[model samples]
Target: MIIFMQLRVNVTEFCIDFNCMKIPSSLLGFFNEIGAASRFVSRYFQEVVQPRYEVKQFIKQCFLIGYRSLPLIGITGFIMGLVLTMQLRPTLIAYGVVSKLPVMVSLAIVREIGPVISALIFAGKISSSMGAELGSMKVTEQIDAMEVSGTNPFKYLVVTRVLAATLMLPVLSVLSDAIGLYGSYLGVNIRDHTSLSLYFFEVFNTLKFGDVLPAIIKTFFFGFAIGIIGCYKGYNSSKGTEGVGRAANSAVVISSLMVFIIDLITVQITDVLGLN
Candidate 1:
C-alpha cells in the first residue's frame, strides 16, 4: 500500500509538472517573438539610415509596392466612401442634417477614415507582399548569398522596402483621401445635387490646418510601422517555405495592430492639443 501510494503521488507530480511547463513555454514563445521583431526593426532603422543608400532598388520597390498597389487601394477607397455615405444618410436625414452631409462626411473621411483606411489597405497589400517576398528570399538562400558576398542583405532588402513603403504610403493616402471625398460627393449627389466647388469650399471651410496636418503626419508613422514590421518579419524568416507564410501573416497582423495603436495615441494627442 505504501509503494502504491508513492507511485500515485509520483504520477500526480509528473502531470502537474507537465502542465506547468506549458504555461511558461507559451509565455517564453510569445516574448521571443516580440523580442525578435523588435530587434529586427531596430536593425532595419540603423541599416536604412547608413551611407551608400540603395536608391535604384528603392525606386524599383516603390514602383513594385506602391504603383502596383494603387488599383486595389483606389477601389477600396471608392467603396469606403460610397458605403459610408450610404450608411450615414439615414442618420443624417433623420436628424435633418442632410445638407450638412458634405462637410460632415468629408471631415469624417479626411480627419480619420482616409488615413486609417488607406493605411489598412496598404498594410494588407504592401506589408504582406514585402514580408512574403523577403521571406521567400530568406528561405531560398538568396539573402544568405548576399551575406556571403559581403553585401549587407539587411540594407539591400530591408531598407529598400521600408523606405519605399514610408514614402509611398503618404502619397497613397493623399490620393485615397481625394478619391474618398469624391465618392462622398457621389453619395451626396445621389440624394441632392451639390457642385464640386461648393462641396470643397465647405470641406476646406470646416477643416483647419490643425485637422489636416496631424492626420497627414500620423500616416507617415503608420507607413513606417508597417514597412519596418513587415520587412523585419520576412528578413528574419525561418529557413523553410512555411516561414514565408508565417512572415507574411505576422507582418499584416502586427502592422494592422500598430496602425490602430498609433492612431489611438495620435487621436489622444491631437485631442489634448484641442484640435477637435
Candidate 2:
C-alpha cells in the first residue's frame, strides 16, 4: 500500500510539472506564419500561369503602383544623392581626392543605395497600402463574396499587384539613379565647379554593365518581396478591424527585412560571379 501511494504521488507530480510547463507561443507562431507565407507564394506561382489572365487589372495596377510612386521616389533619390555627396565631400577633400567624388557617389548609389533605398521607400508606401486595402476587404467579407460570385479574387488582386511591383521597380530604380546623379551634380557645384556634362561623363565612365545590370535585376526581387509580403499578410489577416492595422504594419516590417536579405544575397552572388 505504501509503494502504491508513492507511485500515485509520483504520477501526480509528473502531471503537475507537465501542466506547469510553458509553451513557446511566440516561436510557434513565427514558424506557423513562415509556413503560411511559403504556401501563399507557392499558390501564387501556380495561379499565375493559369488561363483567364487579368490583363486589364494588371495594367491598372502598374499605373497605380509605378506612376503614382515616381514623384516621391524621385524627390527622395535626389536628396539622397545630394546629401551623400555633401557628406562624402569633406572626407574626400581631406584626402585631396575630391575629384573622385562623382565616381564614388555614383557607384555607391547605383550599386547599392539607390535600389535599396527606393525599395524600402516603396515598401513603406506600397506594401502598407496593399495590406490595409486587402485586409479591409478580407474583414468586410468582400474577398469571400468574390469567391462566392465565382471570381478568382487572388488572381484579380494579388497577381496583378505582384506583377506590377515586379515590373515597375526596375523602371523606378533607373529613374531614381538618373535623378540622384543630377542631384550629385548640383551638390558637386556647391563647393566645387563641375559642369553637368562632366558630372554625367564621370558617372558613365565609372559605371559598367556589371554594376548596372545586377542593380536593376535585384530591384525586381525587391519589388516581388514587397508585393508578396504585403499580399500575404493582408490576405491572411484576421481579428476584424484591428487586423487591417496589423497587416499593414507587418507588411512593411517583413518587406523591409526581405529587401535587406535579398540585397545581401545579391551582393554575395555578385561577389562570387565577379560582377562586384
Candidate 3:
C-alpha cells in the first residue's frame, strides 16, 4: 500500500511538470512585450510634457536624424521618380493619353510614394542606428550609470530622438517630392519633348491642399512610430553583446512594418474623410 501511494504521487508530479512544459512561451512573451512597449510609450508622453526639457540634445538629434539623412533620401527619391516615370511612360503612351503623364506622376509621388518611401528609408537608417546606439549603451551599463548619476536617461535619449523624428520626416517628404518631380521631368524629356515650365505647371495644377496635407500629416505619425519603436527596443535590450545586434535588427524590422501599417491606416482614414 505504501509503495503504490508513492508511485501515484510521482506520476502526478511528472504529469504536472509535463503539462507546464507544454505551454507556449513565445506567445506569452509576445503579449508581455506588447504590454511593456505600451507602458514605455505612455511614459514618454508623460516625460515629454514635463519641465526641464532636453533642448540641446533634441537639436543634436534633429541634425543627426534629419540633416545627415538628406543625401540618401534625396538620391532615393530622385531615382524612384525617374524609374516610375520611365516605367509609366510606355503604358501612358499605349493608352494615348501620354500628355497626362506629368499630372499622374506628380500626384502619385506627392500623395503616396514620396512620404511612404522616404519614411521607409528613414526607418531603415535611423531606427537601426538608434537601436544599435542605445543597445550598446544598455549592454555597456551606460544607461545604468546615467540613472545612478541622477540623470533622466529616458528623457534625454528617447524623447529627443522621438521628437526629432516626428518633426523631420515631413520636411524630408516635402524635399523628396520636389526632387521626385524633377526626376519625373527628366524622365518625360527622355523619350518625348516637354518644356520644364509646362511640366511643373501641369504637376502643380493637379495638386491641392487636401492631397498634400493628409500625406504630410501621416508622415509625422510614421516618424513617431519609427522613433518610438527603435527607442523602445534598444532601451529594453538584454544585457549582452548579442542584445545590441538583436535590438538593431528588430528595430528595423518593426519600424518598417509600422510604416506600412501606419500608411494603411492613414489611407483608410483619408478615404473615410473623403480626403482621398
Candidate 4:
C-alpha cells in the first residue's frame, strides 16, 4: 500500500510539472505571431528577387514615398534642430562651451537624433498608410483579383514599396540633416550673432566620416524595417475592416520599435569598431 502511495505521489508530481511546463495560450500566440512574421519576411525576399520587374510601379512609389514625404520631413527636421539648439544653448553657456554649440548640435543631429526622429515620423505616416492601403486591398480581395488576373501582386505592390522606402529614406535623411543644420544655424543666430559660414564651418569641422557614414548606413536599415513591417501587416491583414485599423496601428508601433532597436545596435557596432 505504501509503494502504491509513492507511485501515485510521483505520478502526481510528474503530471504537475508537465502541466507547468506547457506553454500558456498567450505566450504561444506571441511565439506563433513571431514565426508567422519570420515566414512573411522570407516570402518577401523570395518574391522580391523574381523577375517581371515592376519598374513603373517602383518609380511611382519612389515619387510618392520620397518626394511627397519631403515637406513633413523638412519641417520636422527644422523644428527639431531649432528646439535642440535653443534647449542646449543655456546648458552650453553654463559649461562655458557655448562656442562649441554648433558642433555639438550637429553631432547630436547627425549621429542619432536626425535618423531616429525622421524614421519615427516616416513610420507614423508611411507605415500606417501602407498598412491601411494594403489592408483595404486585402480586405476587398484586390490581391485575389490580381492573382486571378495573372498579375504579380507581391512584386507589383510589396517589392516596389519596399525598395522605394529602402532607397528613399537615406536621401530623405540626408536632406533632413542639411535642413536641420540650417535651422540650427538660425537658432544659434537667434541668441547671438553667428555668421552662416561660421556656424556651418563649426559644424562641418567637427563631424567626421565616422559619424556621418554610420548614421547613413543605419537609416537604410530603418527604412527597410519600416517598409517590410508595414507591407507585412497590410499584406497579411484579415478580419475585414477591423483588421485594417489594427494593421495600421501595429505597423506604426512595430516599425518605430524597430527603428530604436536598429539604432541601439548600430551604436553598439560603431562603438565596437571605434567609429564613435
Q: How many clashing residue pairs appear in each of the predictions shown? A: 0, 0, 0, 0
lDDT of 4: 0.91
lDDT of 4 by residue, 69-174 (tens): 9999999999999999999999999999999999899999999999999999999989999999999999999999999999988888999999899999999999
lDDT of each: 0.85, 0.92, 0.91, 0.91
Model 1 misplaced stretches (Cα beyond 4 Å): 1-23
For model 3, residues 100-146, the per-residue Cα lDDT tens digits are: 99989999999999999999999999999999999999999999899
Question: Each prediction's TM-score against the native?
Answer: 0.89, 0.92, 0.92, 0.92
Candidate 3 regions with alpha-carbon error over 4 angstroms: 1-23
- Tens-place lDDT per residue, model 2, 68-169, is 999999999999999999999999989999989989999999999999999999999999999999999999999999999998999999999999999999
Scanning candidate 1 in windows of ten residues, the lowest lDDT window is: 1-10
Q: TM-score for model 3? A: 0.92
Estimate the TM-score for candidate 1.
0.89
Model 2, which residues run further than 4 Å from truth?
1-23
- Candidates 1 and 3 compared: the better one by TM-score is 3
Residue 151 CA error for candidate 2 (Å)? 1.0
Alpha-carbon error at 26 in model 2, in Å?
Answer: 1.4
